[model samples]
Target: MTFASWQFAVFAAIVFGVYYLPPVRPFQVQLLVAASLFFYGYGQPELLPLLGIAVGGTYLFLVLALRDRRWLPVGIIFNLALLAFFKYKFLFFDPQAPALVDIAAIDFLLKLPLPIGISFFVFHNISLLVDLTRDKKAPLPSPTDVFLYIIFFPQLVAGPITRAGLFLPQIEPKRFSDVQLVEAAKWILIGFFFKLYVANNLNEMTSHMDFPFYETLQTQDRWLLVILYGYQIYADFFGYSAIAIGLGLLFGYRLPINFDLPYISASFSEFWTRWHISLSTWLRTYLYIPLGGNRCGKFRTYLNLIIVMGLGGLWHGVGPSYLIWGVMHGLLLAVERPFLKKFEGIKSAGFRALRIAAVFFCVTMLWIFFKLPNFDHALAYLAGMFRPSTNPNPTKLYYDLALLYSLPVILQHLHLNSFFERRLAAWEPYVYGALAALAYLEAGPATAFIYFQF
Candidate 1:
């Protein structure tokens, strides 16, 4: 169930009540496992077996590898193969191939649904095995712990992608302090505001505009739409991460921060570092470092960055647009590295602001490829932004609505950067109350988070 839904609200409330009861507290881990499995299987019961196989197989393989060490590859391959079969099958194979008509089994396999959160869970399992193999001194978690780590409901879907080492220790029961409860409530309130009010409203505003009509808009209107989309996606994904982290805290598990004001980043490399912090860390640790990272020569390092990012993009979806998006960032990063080094000594505030603006503009433009389904449509939209249009002008109402909706988020970013330089702790309660009221008054509709499709 989506976080914005009444169903999830009821589910969370019931789970929270049961979890904190004195008698039920000791069996918290088992209770959470059962709750998580139900959460994952609520919409698709058929996929429950797949999750079981992944959890079971990974745990078993890790156990075997502890003795033989040779079983490590076997474990890794098994998980990766399962991931590829579900995620990449449609991209790599044709179900209707003439020769496959005689083989009903092959066609059926090709037509299977891509399991929800397959990418996330597979990465978690892989990290578990890799860490075990790398650190022989580390203790192996019991199968129950392994299952909980992979299926914890808060992060089971779109995730901050917790590591086994960081998350496992928190499985033990702990007292929930008032301070922790307040902090979790604060995050949940902010998350609801972002998703229900900001992202959902923006989605409704732009829902009518499709590729066919995009070329008919004036240049100014197109740019405005593009800017709105940039913030919409940011709010949607960041909102999900905020809720996940807040829920993790409620459960006494500290999940990592996923975002850090990415729009203000001064370079593409810095952008990656700030945005999706957990996934980027995973990619660096698991994929980049193993491929020699920057330890190799400059050329190899550039190649590694490209390959890693390209795969990272493909990880999001098996689409040409996604690949192009990755390649664009990789190329920009490669070019920005030497430029950043040469200008490292520039300390002017004006220069810094200019750099931030330049980076933001570039990133916003690149988001065209990320948003559009077709590569050609993205290119056409970019072209429309440059060439003058004789089409009808967008109404002043549209501009005003866009500005009103977007201003709050922009002010939030400024406040985060210490622009006001005022202490907000004393006003925290009122701030939360204001956010909640705004969300309640302005919420458009219950909508799935953008990252859920991934």
Candidate 2:
């Protein structure tokens, strides 16, 4: 169930109540495993078996690999193949080719609903296996811990993808202190505000501007829509991560932070470092470093960066737009390397602001590709955003609402960058309370997070 939905609220409440009870506390790991399985299977029960197979198979291969290190590739291939069958099968085999009945069989496979979080969990399993092989001194986890690590509900679906080493230790029993509980509550409150108030409202406000209709809007209005969408996605994804981290803390675990004021990043390299921190870290460790990250020559390093990012983009979805988006970022990053070295000594406030603005503009512009599935439609929207047209003017109400929803995030980034750090910290409770009230009053209809589709 979606975090914004009443169903998830009810589910979480019941789970937390049962979990904290004195008698039930000892079985916390088992209870959480059951709860997490239920959470994952709530909407699509049919996929539970597939998920079980992935988990069980990975665990089995890992066990075997411990015995005969040669089984490592077997384990990686098996997990990756499972992911490929569900996620990228369509990318390789077209369903509608006007062929014989054989093609119809492939079409049926294409029609099967994709299991949610396949991308995330597969990567988690791969990381676990790879880490085990790399660090032979590390002991193997029990089967139960392996299952829990792969299927923990908090970050299971859209992850700050956890590493086995990082999360396994937290499976032991623990009690939450009042201070910890308060901190967790604060994070949950802030997450709800971001998702319910800002992201949801902005999504509703811009929902009508799709494809052909989006291209028909005035240049200025389209630009506004693009900019608003950029924030909408940021709020939606960041909101999910915050909630996940908060929930982990409530249960005495600390999930990794995902976003760190990415919009204010002064370069594409810095942007990647700040945004999706966990996934970027995973890519660097599992993919980039293995491919000879920057340890190779300059040309190979550039190629590695592009390949890693391109694969990273494809990991989000099997679409041309995603590939283009990755390529764009990779090229920007490659171009920025020399410039970054040259500007390393220049740290003036004005120069930093200019650099931040330039990076933000480039990043936001590329988001058009990320938002639109059809390449031609993305191009048309960009065309409309740049060229002159006599479309109807957007209402002042629209402008005000968009600005209102977006301003808090901008201010949040400023605070994160230490613009008003002391003042914000002093007024923290009042600011949080105000945001909480606004969220309650202005919350739009419940919707799934944007990252859920990935």
In model 2, where is the ten-residue run with the lowest total lDDT?
92-101
Give candidate 2 misplaced runs (Cα > 4 Å): 92-110, 392-397, 416-421, 424-427
State in Å the error of residue 152, model 2.
0.6
Candidate 1 C-alpha lDDT tens digits along 328-407: 78778777877887666888888888888998998888788888858888888888889888767543337677877787
Encode model 2's per-residue lDDT on 366-388: one tens digit a residue.
88888886888888878877678
Cα TM-score per model: 0.94, 0.94
Scored by Cα lDDT, where does model 1 land?
Answer: 0.83
lDDT of each: 0.83, 0.84
- Candidate 1 versus the native: TM-score? 0.94
Deviation of model 1 at 186, angstroms: 0.6
Q: Who wins the lDDT comparison?
A: 2
